[model samples]
Target: MVLTVSDLAVARGGAPVLEGLSFSVAPGEALVLRGPNGIGKTTLLRTLAGLQPPIAGTVNFPEDTGAYASHADGIKAQLTVTENLAFWADVHGADLVDSVFEAFDLVDLRDRFAGTLSAGQKRRLGLARLGVIGRDVLFLDEPTVSLDGFSVKMFASWLRDTHLALGGIAVIATHIDLGLDAPELDLTPFKAAPDARGGSDEAFL
Candidate 1:
């Protein structure tokens, strides 16, 4: 299913940050969110992902076709690399594939405990979870955080060659270059009015 947003207005700290935003991401496509820091990229992504109510606008997409990945790894410290993927896969009724391990360069560490991994390694393991689930739409914020230059390329390659190739749609907010071929949506002009602050849930329409 295609993901579409129209005249979207989003808030941060109960104050509107971005508004009058419109965009669509078709299956097999990706869109990169680019703007200065505090330009509300995260807020926009959260709004699109339905994590929080938007001040106003419409977000259209099939229910349960999306997944959000924030900066946090969200991994279990006690589980091994393989075990971690197994857990998420089971939750989604999917299977752990070799590509997921190879994509994140976690093959050598398959038996390693997540708690003992370094920061970057842990980050890779966390991102590897995306491959475990079969979700078609990805809302990612700073997905490459803590990853080294090489690991970032691994992620970029996987995202392009595997994820997008298989008809997944991604809306990502990142400062670094993951080498994605997606269009960039700059949110600078969409900044909300200074007076666009708190309002009732009815305003979310």
Candidate 2:
């Protein structure tokens, strides 16, 4: 499995949020996390990305898994769009190429300074980082939060197309549904643990 979760559980403020949750994903697939607010969707994604350790359980990745999480400020504010991408490319040890610019639709903005770009533009640039790297699995949390409808559609389309083109695994946690082309694992219940206590409050504590 490109990604695997076994008996995962998490707690915040001394209360368990997710328990006994397990799932797996392979290449050329996209998994979506759907849930109400404050239900641990982001927490699960963070755990899967290895940004947070689960209270109990295990997450396994392939030996060469390349991963990126949201809110990392992938772009260098002091640099132009191309410059920022080049920096990431260098970090990932990837060959800088025009395809990364074409993948994220940033060709026109390549010469523009990253700091002056809008939030949606910056997010798109961040997504473009994947194209520059050779990661087998990709993780994105709320990737479309600041995007307008047009940009959102563009990104969804791009994501679907890229999965097909590269045969990679993409896991995204977003409230706005992308209608992805791959199987989606809705994580709401796993996050909330609706059946965790079996309707009894006595065991919750």
Candidate 3:
């Protein structure tokens, strides 16, 4: 499947952040979003994930083929790791719980409550949702936030093997290196220039 974004403009709090951005991700390709903070990286991901409205342009991808994983680990504190993954797998119509658990190295913690896991463990559990969802395109926002060095490497390897290897697409917004040689979209040039309204003749008079 292909994910396409054309002439996209995104705004936050009624103020324009990015404009005229265009890009595409084909099967087995990964696009890494790189830029300093507050540069609309998150907004762009959210927009492409269909979580928010774009100020202009279009994002086209197959329905049910796109999955989004934000920085926050959306896990239920009271649920066990297995239960958590099972819930998402059911929601996404995926039946790969055992594979996902193995992929994230969560098999040992299958019966552990999410609330008892450490930050890194919880992050891993959260990321495991991607496998359970079984979508073709993944939108990851700072996926390595709470992961340890080894966990990061493991997740990166899984991404390369499962997603890219299987002809899936991924768009990741992260400051850390996932060790993948994906093309990058720096938001610096796409940043919207400040409005020029004050320079009008009426203001100068």
List the lowest-lDDT window of 10 residues for candidate 1.
196-205
User: On residues 1-205, what C-alpha lDDT tens digit does candidate 1 reach at each position?
Assistant: 8999999888876778898998899999999999999999987887788888888889999999899999899899999999999999999999998988888999999999999999999999999999999999999999999999999999999899999999999999998887788899888999988888763342332
The per-residue C-alpha lDDT of model 1 at residue 112 equals 96
- Cα deviation of 161 in candidate 2 (Å)? 1.7
User: Residue pairs in steric clash, candidate 1?
Assistant: none
Question: What are the TM-scores, per candidate, against the unseen true structure?
Answer: 0.95, 0.85, 0.93
Q: Model 1: residues >4 Å from true position, as ranges? A: 197-205
Cα-based lDDT for every prediction: 0.90, 0.75, 0.87
Local error of candidate 2 at residue 150 (angstroms) = 2.4
Residue 119, candidate 2: Cα error in Å is 1.7
lDDT of 2 by residue, 123-156 (tens): 8888787777778788888887778888788778
**Candidate 3, residue 78: lDDT:** 100
- Model 3: lDDT of residue 125: 96
Q: Judged by lDDT, which candidate is best? A: 1
- When 1 and 3 are scored with lDDT, the better candidate is 1
